[model samples]
Target: MSDQLVMIIDGMPHTGWKEASIARSIERGPHNFSLQLSEIWNTEKQVNRRAIEQGMSLQAYLNDDLFMSGYINELAPSYDANNHTISIRGSSRLGDLVDCSTTGKAFAGQSLLQISQSLCAPFGITVHVDASAKKAANQIFNKSKRLDLGEPIWEFLEELARVRAVLLTSNANGDLIITRAGTGYADVALALGQNIKTASGNFSGRELFSQYTVSGQQSNEPSVKLESVDTVLPIATVNGSGRYRPFAVAADDDMDVAGCKTRAEWQRNVNQGRSESVVYTVTGWRQTPDGRIWAPNERVIVSDPYQGLLNAERLIVETRLMLNERGRNTELRVMPKNAFDLIPEVESAASEGFIR
Candidate 1:
């Protein structure tokens, strides 16, 4: 603890709170938290239905570091003849994006940056694009539309991010960020015998399709067929070895045979890379040695023999932090760097358990 944990409710800092936890993600989703307070003798510190009705805003800080800022979305109070406590659950500013529905908008030739800026303007968020983002600032959206059925702005933006191999996240100051996946972040090494408390590794080939056949069909054009196979070294010798698993795809529009082949190959490589994953639980909120905060999208070095991993560099795809009266801990979900380059899956088989 850096002696700077502060929880502000409606701009007023309150002390003596218990059992607080905040969760943030790089998936362009909402960050949320749960807080508990004792109401035994503090009449002025009680949170009740009135607070919920008034839409109480919340801001949290850890030693000069902004942890969470949002509004109270849910409130629950529990009282017994012997004990008294009030618990509140809420989300961050991203909640506004998740709840607001958009009425079918068309961006015939607008760049992704322009579209994101326009969409996030209503929420009072500034959108920042990384210099290394795949799509240029002026690149036009050839054809994109929000359906008439209406959907959350966050959901719509998430779809675009997926297709473009980009990530959307918010900074400590509550500004929106659009950047390429796994880029623009520093790598932190997590030594097994040092700061890491517990770790587990899991690898699966159940859904690994060793072969893919793609067929591209265009209006008034001949159908073209292409095949892609998994032969990327190390991975080829392990989970994908001797497995002739086959999958197929039907590409729409004017995709030629070469394009289909490239797409299939890319998909095969990504799936192969994602088959293996590692989960690490560290003691502190930040990585040891450097004291930098652990965040998603950054790279980390793992050296643990119990998991059969040694001096391996991996990408941090997800991170979860838990803070309470006891202590603070961080959990990280990591995968091979290649996993970040694959195209997002739009659909998948109902049953992926069978190897064939």
Candidate 2:
């Protein structure tokens, strides 16, 4: 059976169509898809409109394997004297979590799994936390004057993931998944003159700080200070005095010197990696050597002399796939594998609730 792309709307599978594309972008949030069909070519225009109005479910599959499943969230039909077509767009079940809000609720001393399950239960979504991930109790409120939980459920969960240095994403089956950031690596390598059609690398230290000093101040007391430095690049080589980045944390019921320090260190590492990133546009959907589909949060070796990178394995942070009249292609945004990986010392302390 050859590879095929199809979209099912209201229980009807559509393979032969004018155009279709699925974009799974974990870094920017929920994955989404779009389909465009001509009115004269089929009856999808009418069926799609009815589905959109009635909020019918939609699912997409590649090679009969489910890739994305969600409800039809948008519909735009067009018609003229010489043309007739309809456009449909939708997002995964994670979109519902982003739309749902939690009000007048407080979650204290609850594990990440518990919080995620509680928030996603109302939307009929399942939560799956990686076994290797640390489950720590956190505090969140929806009605407190000091802490308002008026934001969407996804936003709340994202904040929780950020503090713990984990990643919150959805699988192709639309299950909410929480895992370590940049932990998955593919065996295939993306090499120039092999599969990569174009490549570019960017490096800059303008936003990076060689030294970070984090201070936590309590009521009428001297502030407790913690410092972290970017050891990847020496201060003497870059600047003698060292570029200082100061972070002040207001002491709260949950704030502590240790938590403040953890935040400072995580921020420093993130910024340092962000200072240098790469983007590669490849020829097809999968790596040439293994035919593995390109996905986010996976590491792949990139070899390109033009970009000054030779067989450097980087983390695939984002991926964009397009299949239309222009043909099929994939674009990848990558960064150092250690970009989001926390320092061993910081990771251990943060997992122990030393970080908020």
Candidate 3:
């Protein structure tokens, strides 16, 4: 048999072995073949690889591949209708995952956390689950019977501990949603589906992990350029006057003379620059006597650089989760906080395209 005979061991497939060392899809000789893994392997527990092989599909098997070969990473590249998720490539989030697992488990890596990277590393990958399908797969796996030949599905399920996925979903209208999905069932689903093919690449965490620094390719970029300045109204004056007036060319030199919008803006720009925005509103702006404007008491409610993106992630994850639980009956509505105002021009539901 050719050493390249692709075989499914447990739930994942391997490209055979040479010199007793398993060959990486990417590093296997000069043939130039590579492995693409699935996004479902991160949070799920494991058992015997052989058991997963009988029923698992090529994609899940790929998940197993990247995992065994040390390549699995966070959930495969995902997107929303607007097309954006979290930019957690180099964030401490992955470190936090490692921290949590190490603290709780007995061994250094009792979870069998496999990793692979020629570049930046990652922690976890969340997925969207199909509730009904998972339930069915679970029932099927639990039964002490066989399919085609006589192998117990539970043996496979036993190898796969129950798991939940961090998934992304969308409404009928195409608004993205987010949340958790079932796992052992995800394993079953993969067994049925073909390999997850990507023109970009396959779903391998090791491959994904190396993406950030692959060939000196900078993963982080300035997609949106935003600038902010801040200033606070002084509570006291040099000469001791609480009732201060705006800077007058002829009168008070009291203003910081920062030649800026507000003291806060000056501090932000000159002090701690590069802060990203989020959902909170910054207020406390005042107009100067010279018609200049300034904001003093305004600060972000959510200062996380990635908070804006994470908000979108949370929404999509929850939405997927709801649909997985409710199926076709699942209905999602993204009512903007100011929805009524956004469409004030439309006076009726009929005018807004409602069937009623």
Q: Taking the tens digit of each residue's C-alpha lDDT, what string does model 1 give over 1-356?
A: 45445777887776556677677766546677787776553345543322332268878776566766778888777675445676888777777888888666666566667878888898787788777674554465555544334667787777666555577776655667777556544445767887678887777776566567766664443333333344353454465456666678776434666666667777776776688788888876766433566777777777888876688777787777666765777788888777667453322221111112
Instruction: For each candidate in the order shown, give its overall lDDT on alpha carbons.
Output: 0.66, 0.65, 0.20
lDDT of 3 by residue, 123-146 (tens): 223222245333322222211211
Please provide, for model 2 over 1-356, each residue's C-alpha lDDT reduced to its tens digit, 9 standing for 90 to 100. Answer: 44567777788776655776677765645788777876442334433332333266787776656767787788887766545677888888898877767563655656567778877787788888776564432333222211135667776677666655567888887888877665667667778887777777777666655455545443433244444444454322344445464545443334356656665666666766676688888766665433566788888877877766798777888887667786667878888755777532222323333233
Alpha-carbon shift of residue 346 in model 2 (angstroms): 12
Instruction: Give candidates' CA RMSD values in order.
Output: 5.9, 5.6, 28.2
The Cα error of candidate 3 at residue 43, in Å, is 33
From the highest TM-score down, the ranking of the candidates is: 1, 2, 3
Query: Could you tell me every candidate's TM-score relative to the true structure?
Result: 0.82, 0.77, 0.14
Residue 269 deviation, candidate 1, in Å?
Answer: 2.5
Residues forming the 10-long window of minimal summed lDDT in candidate 3? 314-323
Model 3 TM? 0.14
Best by lDDT: 1
- RMSD (CA, angstroms), candidate 3: 28.2
